[model samples]
Target: MTVLDALPSVEHAAVLDESSKREIRRAILTAIAVPGYQVPFGSREMPVARGWGSGGLQLTLAIVGPDDVVKVYDQGEDGGVNAANLRRLIRRSEGVETTTDPRQATVIQTRHRVPEDELRADQTLVLQVPVPEPLRGVERDMNELRRMHAEGDYSKMWVSLYEDLVRNGVITETTGYPCLVGGRYVIATTPIPRWDVPPLHQAAFLSLFSAGREKRIYAIPPYTDVEPLTFEDVPFEVEKVSARCRCGLVVPDGDLQSYQVEIPQQDGSSVWACSDTDWCTRQRVEAGLLDPSAITETEVDL
Candidate 1:
């Protein structure tokens, strides 16, 4: 029996038809050919809710093959409800191997956070985007925004950013900042935190951003320039956290600082632990930090 036939009815609903898959694949090929150009596609309705990462899910289904190892993350946590649910859906429908480790995966479909580990050349990052249009904030009309992108008219966006820097001494836009890709079209990346922005600049892996709600898909080809919109005098800055958790995870370039925990009645004390579940688990295994006997059955599912 085929992979889809093996899944139960509820899980099978996640699978898109062959025609839809073909169309998505064609769009992806076109996106890769014209890097950074936002290619419109007929986004298929997913089993999941529209705003809840259906775009990333669709991309995952389209690119995933029987031999590929998939990884899904929601805000850097792979074991979270959203991530786990998507993982199960893909596994059930495609019956492909899945992984929590970024290095092991061929395709990683993520929401709002890239992994701390740098992805390999063979990996693909599928980012779920809420609004694909970078000019949505400046120009309300979609047609006008398309025209602005087509004509390379981004003076208004640059002016607003200049005004913001003058007023606040920094760019006010925090997440999903506009970026010029391959020195041509400006595209809005997924609403990832500023900390993840630098990784997009000539990244090793191919990056794909899909917006199911907006019905748009774009790509940043491997080794392509992805410069965040900024002035030369005042460069873009990523947020740096120095708080050292008791878990012994060290930031190579970050300074060591105390991490405090809130308690009911006792005084707060410094401790260190990883906020990223997958990274923490990987580290624990590598460092022999975790007890193998304590590993539960659920933990072995991945």
Candidate 2:
């Protein structure tokens, strides 16, 4: 039996036909050519349901090859149900190798988080987006939304944000914050936390966003400007993790703060742990701080 026939139904669905790959590639090229612009395309069949990262899977399948190393993560976890299943599908369907390490992956498909590591120039980060429209909150009418986007009229969005600031004392949005890419086109930053948002601004790797249900694809090319929509007085800030990690590491500024997760303790209180388990283990290994298993004689440089 062939690889396609041997696998289960879900994996079988992801093994896209050649025509679908070509159409996805065409959409990708168009998206890259016009940064932050949501280019519409025909959403093809994939294993996952509409809102469950089918778009990202399709994009990865179109470009990933046998030699490529793929990684899929859901909220920074490599072993989560979603991540594990998707990674298995990609590997089994295409015969491409898979890795949990961000450093080793050529294309990293993510559900709602970006890797904490500084992505290399050669890598491509594909973010799965449930909602691709940044202005949807401000404008409900599709025709009017298109017209506003075409005319670059974001006055209502600015007003809405101002109202949010007035009522909440801060921009209350925790994820899917809107951002201006390439100094034009205010695009939704795909449910990534405020912490993950900064790396996308002037980063080394290219970022692709796909919405399977929405049938749209968009991109932020390498080294492009990505500015969060905020007031001059109210500068954008990431959520802070104040507690020390059980790994004997203190919360370091300017690096992967969003990767921190709160762990409940024996008491009613809780502590913080780095959600990027690989990075945390590496830190422990390198420092010789606590865990010996995570520590090896030689370490791989991130």
Candidate 3:
């Protein structure tokens, strides 16, 4: 028998040791203390790669409790490969309830996109960040980036936006948009689409960001001001989905719901549906259009 198989079976409820969990908890406390400021921590090795939701896994595992109902998703699909695997990890933790419904989840971890449903104050949204620094594009040196944040000088980023507007005729930036948080720090809301950026502003739920590759954790507390960087005349706009969802729901451009082309059909006409599968299912079920048993967890790649 293999060495692992030969050993007596053992059950461990928590993933990280108490010492490590405590350290992560301390860092999260500080991240909340200074909203939008990235706080570095000792990132531990995980079964998954660093950039692909490892950071988020750490954050979820660190704070998850016996009573917490956890939800994990990639681009809002609960059954996405990344989400399923991460959920598996947490579900393995004894007494930690897991659910697909955002309304029931106490802690929801996400990558790339936010849920279509409005989040409540009781929930904690943990966002996985591939790159934690907002100034990384403009400044290469870490010291300079730190100094820029400390001095509240973000002229370089402003110039970058100006250049983007001048050259592209419009701000082509969509995902990973930079936003000003608490009117003090410019934070990188990486991987989250422009459509998802608005919910971070004056949000009822606490938002936490973790980047394992960069070993940084940041936070945006409830009801904080989060403004997207934009010119005075050119107001920020989210992406437009021309087609109505397959469920016959058509929200406005900046609505909380996000749309994605449903599995491409042979007819070439793209079919759109809510990216947040659980939310869509719940909506239809509530409307009496879909049966509760008809709900299926769909697998998607972010």
Candidate 4:
């Protein structure tokens, strides 16, 4: 049987323990009532490294059921070492099916990039955040940062960015962009590509950001305000690609290119694919955009 066909059918009760479901339900309710507050829970130790997607796994285990389809991606690709590692853990621990199709997934755990397509309201996107503090650079003490946030003191962050612009012609930030949620809470939206930032603004889905090592959890519920930290004159800008994919279709507006060596048996030919492997596979299937070395003609013309 094909890999897809060989997969076992989901059985809800078999997937989630009663205790896990109760814990997650409580956390979700607490998150909603407190708004921007961080809710600490008994985070379990995973077989993977602590800094990896442990935070995502914790949240997933809490909410995932036997019947739910899970999708995990790192830098947009399912084949990335980190994504593959997490997928194995989930399958072994929970026995839920995994997929590359965004439409089929009920839960998606991602690092550094968000899917190019708009997420549905029913979907839950969990981000693996390395750091989740907007005031972390200035105040090393969590207590001090909390006070700064309480007083709405963000002038230091603005000044730092201004100085960065003076030194380098543009804002030198490449990841871990800070944003304001509900116009009150200054939250770090994690390292998602700037291209995906706009989608988080009043998005339809629930966006959860967690830093396991740092011991923090934050949320941006549907229809909430989320704006990138920017000055009035210097508006926030998403990344741009100068060239389209050689496959003839325009790369998803914010998709980034990644390189890998492929040795073809014929003459040791090499080629590259989307860095976000899961994203690329979905695009390939849905849009019929084939890699130059894989096929002769465009499989499906966009």
RMSD per candidate (Å) reads: 4.3, 4.5, 3.6, 6.8
Query: What tens digits encode model 2's per-residue C-alpha lDDT throughout 34-132?
Result: 899999989987777888888999999998876799999988878788887788778877778888889999999997788888999999999999999
User: Which portions of model 4 miss their true places by more than 4 Å?
Assistant: 1-21, 251-273, 285-302
Clashing pairs in 2: none
TM-score of each: 0.87, 0.89, 0.91, 0.80
Arrange candidates by TM-score, descending: 3, 2, 1, 4
Q: List per-prediction Cα lDDT, in the order shown.
A: 0.80, 0.85, 0.85, 0.71
Expressed as tens digits, the lDDT of each residue in 216-288 for candidate 1 is: 8899999999999988888788765555445565543554222122123345654445545677666666778
Against the true structure, candidate 1 has what lDDT?
A: 0.80
Candidate 3 C-alpha error for residue 25, in Å: 0.7
Q: Model 2 shows how many backbone clashes?
A: 0
TM-score between candidate 3 and the true structure: 0.91
lDDT of 3 at 70: 91
Better of 2 and 4 by lDDT: 2
Q: Candidate 3, residue 275: CA error in Å?
A: 0.7
- The candidate that wins on TM-score is 3
User: Of models 3 and 4, which has the larger TM-score?
Assistant: 3
Colliding pairs, model 3: none
